[model samples]
Target: MKKACFCGTFDPVTQGHLDLIQRATRLFDEVVVVIGVNSDKHTMFPLDQRKKWLEESLKDLCHVTVQARAGLATEICKEIKANVLIRGVRNGVDLEYEKNMAAMNHLLDPSIETVILLASEDKMHCSSSNVREFLRYNRDVSQMVPACVAKDLKEGGKA
Candidate 1:
């Protein structure tokens, strides 16, 4: 079966991320959503917490699964036997950035292909950073993130 890996920090999975994963599922038999941790960046939530949030947010998606990972994304893709690397892009800048990364990913593993999915216009501006900032100021992010994540952020009272 054809499989794809959608890797991201998903500090909090935004609606845009979900849009991409949902769209990807239509094209691939299964999609493994990878919550990758970049040591250089400070994450708002822990890996386990992020994993749980993702699991909760994506529970309804039958062909999707979540995994908390650290290290090279290509390595994770290989481990999962994902033939495609899925990424969500919002605009020109995002497109350019993803394109470069796709090239690098190809250099790392020629067998794996990169697919760029554009975020819906409504959710194009929503991002994990935006969610963190909204929560940091106690703004309602119910519209930006999944209901489960919004609830967690409100209850946890953390950014």
Candidate 2:
């Protein structure tokens, strides 16, 4: 079976990320959604909470698996026997960076391929940062994310 790995910080799982995963799932037999475990950047939702949120978000997607990435995603992909690295790009800047990374991954492991999936129109402007900012100011961000997550943020009163 063909396997792919989609890596991201997913500070909070947004509809954008979900959309990408859903699209990627169609092409690969299985997709591994990797949430990067780098804590240098202060995130509103930590790894464990984010993992729980992602699990809930992806409950219905049987072929799509979720995992926490401790370091390099390519390393995880190699370990998991994934030949494709999936990434979602919104615009030119994203494409440029991904292109560079793709080349580096090829150099590191020539067998691994990088796949770039563009975000859908509805998800184009949505991001984890935007969601967090909206919640930080007590704005309505439910429409951009899962209902359960919205309630979690609201009930936790973290915003």
> TM-score: which candidate is best?
1
lDDT, candidate 1, 90-146, per-residue tens: 999999999999999899999999988889999997899988888778788889998
Lowest-sum lDDT 10-residue window in model 2 = 150-159
Worst 10 residues of 1 by lDDT: 150-159
Cα lDDT tens digits for candidate 2, 23-73: 888999999988888857788877888898898999999898888867776
TM-score of each: 0.95, 0.93
Candidate 2: pairs in clash? none
The local distance difference test score of each candidate is 0.88, 0.87
| Error of model 1, residue 137, in angstroms | 2.1
